[model samples]
Target: MAQLFTPLTLRGITLKNRIVISPMCQYSAEDGFTNDWHLVHLGSRAVGGAALILLEATAVSAEGRITPDDLGIWKDEHVPGLRRITDFLKAHGAVAGIQLAHAGRKASHSSPWKGGAVVPASEGGWTTVSPSAVPFTENEPAPHELTLAEIQQIIEDFRVATRLSLEAGFQVIELHGAHGYLLHEFFSPLSNRRTDQYGGSFENRVRLLLEVTEVTRAEWPTELPLIVRISATDWTEGGWTPAESVQLAKLLKDRGVDLIDCSTGGNVPAAQIPVGPGYQVQFAEQVKREASIPTGAVGLITDARQAEDIIASGQADVVLLARESLRDPYFPLHAAFELGVDVAWPPQYERAKPRRR
Candidate 1:
């Protein structure tokens, strides 16, 4: 049987299979509100037979948004639409999950369709915040360096967001610590050049992320799981390394993080990343082995056989897919056929199931 089609449990939540819908930003919200587009975009995957369906990079504060259109759970008003989506996902069998994020210096950009450029304040963008004032690139504006008070406020934002995610009925919450976002900024020396307690040494640079995890855990229910996604390496010399990620994963696991979703690169514009199938899987393996915590493998994972091999080989506990899920929401269902794994299709789609040759 395909290990990818087998059930896996974290905390009190049991996913029907090992396939997880990796969080992919839609850049399709208005005023940080989720709408019908989000409903269909996420819900159809549940109906298509995924074990877990995660909402995109949702902002924990309005100013933390990657784009003006990014979804937000910073306010109580955002809970209703999220409730609608989670309710539907649970009713259909998939465990509803969400990735809570703050974009840091990467915030205030146009949506990809609108060219994804940094929008000036006059063009609807607000000043971005980070552990330091360093901009993501030369063309981007220098962000406001967060003061001690502001850093504490951001932690509260995550706490409140976690509370709202629980109230909205999501079973899993992933702290977005990857992709050079706010948490990633704290982890990457290239992005965080602060001399305060939030930067300089490795321990100082990791302090904010741990503080956020502690606060989030205090607010989130014990029965639900908290996953933290980390970029295992910045892929540059003197950047955040896989060893640091392993140590961070161990610290996170000690702080009650259930899983480490491992991905790499995206810290600097000029960092050389060796991208290919399973390119990032070794990081997951090292973290899982060294930290003794479950890790989810992602990046260039496109086929059922490859996903199953990752799990079967003990490289990762979960195989997360971004582009593959986009290409086929029914990827799991199709994978079941190819891997000789039995998975029940939604009755409405049963007639469309592949037949034995």
Candidate 2:
């Protein structure tokens, strides 16, 4: 049997299979409101038979967005639109998850299609915030260093976002601590240089993420899964490393994080990454074994056999696909066939199901 097709339980939620639709930003929202575009984009995946459909890095606050068009769960009003998407996903037998995020200094950029460059306030951009007053790139404007009070407010924002996620019916909540975003900014020495309680030493650097998780877990229901996605490495010297990832994963597991979605790089622009097929699987494997927690392996995992190997060999509990899921929202359904697993198709598409050779 294909291990990828087997059920994997995290907390009280049992994923129907090991395939997860990693969050891919649509960059289609306005004022943090989801719309028909989101419905079709996410709904189609659920209809295609993915075991879990995770929403993109949804901002915990409006100003935390990486781009003005990124999705937001910052307000109570954002719940209804999200509820619609979650309903559609659940009705189709896919678990609905959301990634709560803050972009930090990486905020206030234009959408990818619009060059993905930093936008001026005149063009709808706003000043970004970070643990330190550092720019992601030297050419980019330096962001405001967050004061201690501001950090407390952000933690409260995450707690409120968790409440809204519950109201919107998300079964899983993944904290976005990867991709050189807000939380990553706090942990990566390349970005965070504070000498206060929130930075400097390893424990201090990870303090913000841990505090955020603790507050979020308190607000999030005990019955659901709470996952954190981390960039296991900055891929640069003296930056966040795989060893630190394992240590952090251990701490997170103790604080009720059910799984670690392992991916790498993004903290430093000058770092060289050896990207390839299953490039970051080792990070997930290390976290899973060393931390003794379930993990979701991500990054360049695009084939059925490769995904199956990861699960069957006990490398990771789940496989998350981002770009491949875009190219084929129905990847899971097709993978079921490739691996000889008999998963159901949506009734409307049953007539087109692949038959045995």
Per-candidate TM equals 0.99, 0.99
Predicted candidate 1 versus true structure: per-residue lDDT over 24-63, tens digit per residue: 9998999999999999999989988899898999999999
Error of 1 at 54 (Å): 1.0
- Model 2: per-residue lDDT, tens digit, 74-192? 88899999999999999999999999999999999999999999999998889999999999999999999999999999999999999999999999999999999999999999999
lDDT of each: 0.93, 0.94
**Weakest ten-residue segment in model 1 by summed lDDT:** 1-10
Model 1 compared with the native: what TM-score?
0.99
